[model samples]
Target: MSKRGKVWLGVAGLVINDEGEWLVVKKSYSGLKGKWSLPAGFVDEGETIDEAVIREIKEETGIDCQVKGLIGFRTGIIRDEISDNMAIFLATPRINQPFVKSERELLACEWRTPKSLVTDHLTSAMLKEMASSTPHETQFCVNETVDPGDIFGYTSYKLFF
Candidate 1:
């Protein structure tokens, strides 16, 4: 029998500003190193995936955002035994503020036109695909927040449909 490792949960956002520009960030490490991709990161303990994505965007770009809906998910075996599942969300900035890039986790944070990202060789295929789809064009899963304290006596609960 094959021993399996724990599955890691991750989140990313297809954040588009009111002007219709997509948010892209360049990380300092991982497969995304030096590549402009959607703002993404691993989910920390005690936080929901939606919260994680919102935090990631804030940390990486200094922009506050709200998740519009669950857009999609990707799941795959990352290594011999470990696996990864990432949820993608369609989001929009809540405030019209300039982005301040994180010097610690990112090399660059910029807003680019979807067409520009699609044509930029520096943009990864995954990012290009994300940028190609707009919030209005893509279908999103319904996201509903529930109070777990009332149901399971937990802190938080979220339902994605």
Candidate 2:
């Protein structure tokens, strides 16, 4: 198969509440429309992955979050797109607040347990890795580096890291 001539680096956050549920979103486009997955999107130039995670969570779920640690990264090759890389980080909300869904872009928002989400056919590899790992005692065996893409209206965000 041939690549789609595009490069992309996406950042996603695994924000769990006191109840131990991860925040997920229904994306509106970019091959993920109508799929329930972790809240994430393309990172921008001059934007750190941490900031992207925080902003993406807020924008998608309307809940403020802070990155706890970098869990790890996962790489995948689409059938016709450039090979993809997604960095998944651990996060928590600043305040114990519930989220309200956005009126645009996202179709819905909900908190789900890892066991239920892991086997989903619609689940992306990024989320599956996070769900498969033990939250407190995970091991990092490798390092991954990736480049970012240019998606219009996708701007860098400032957040508490």
Candidate 3:
């Protein structure tokens, strides 16, 4: 069986706090409602991934950030039943700005210690990734019986430091 492919481009931010915690948002909309994950969203056409990341951060957290470096990439099946390619980037919050959660995209936004996330409710991959100090590469097809090609199209992005 061949999987029907659909391409998706997304950006995620690894925002760090003074306490060494990471900023994450609790999605309240479709797809992954109530699930804890990094602040992220789909990239608009003609929009650079870096722009998307910064925009998403402000939309979801209402804070300005400076991109630091590429954290890594995460490719997997989303609850929408589509394959998603996400580029994670490390970011530092700008000084003297407060973040207000956007009720449209997030129900709550908070800073969580890396260690706290490991024990609390979080995406399995997110928890594991946070536990590691070094960048890692990982790929897995959910519902293994489905063919990768038929499952989704590959979306690509360029990383900017």
Q: Each model's C-alpha lDDT?
A: 0.75, 0.69, 0.69
Arrange candidates, best lDDT first.
Answer: 1, 2, 3
- On the 0 to 100 scale, the lDDT of residue 124 in model 2 is 52
Which numbered prediction scores highest in TM-score against the true structure? Answer: 1
Model 3 regions more than 4 Å off: 1-5, 77-82, 122-124, 132-161
Candidate 3 lDDT by residue in tens digits, 1-161: 13325566788998997777788888887545676778998887788999999999989999899999776666665444666677888898987467789988888888877777666755434533444443443222122222223223423222221
lDDT of 2 by residue, 13-72 (tens): 888898898888878776666666788877877888888888888888899988989876
Query: TM-score of the candidate numbered 3?
Result: 0.73
User: lDDT score of model 3?
Assistant: 0.69
Model 2 lDDT-worst window of ten: 152-161
TM-scores, all candidates, are 0.78, 0.72, 0.73
Point out the worst 10-residue segment of candidate 3 by lDDT: 139-148
lDDT of 3 at 70: 74
Off by over 4 Å in 2: 1-5, 79-81, 119-122, 135-138, 141-161
> Tell me, what's the RMSD of every candidate?
10.7, 8.1, 7.0
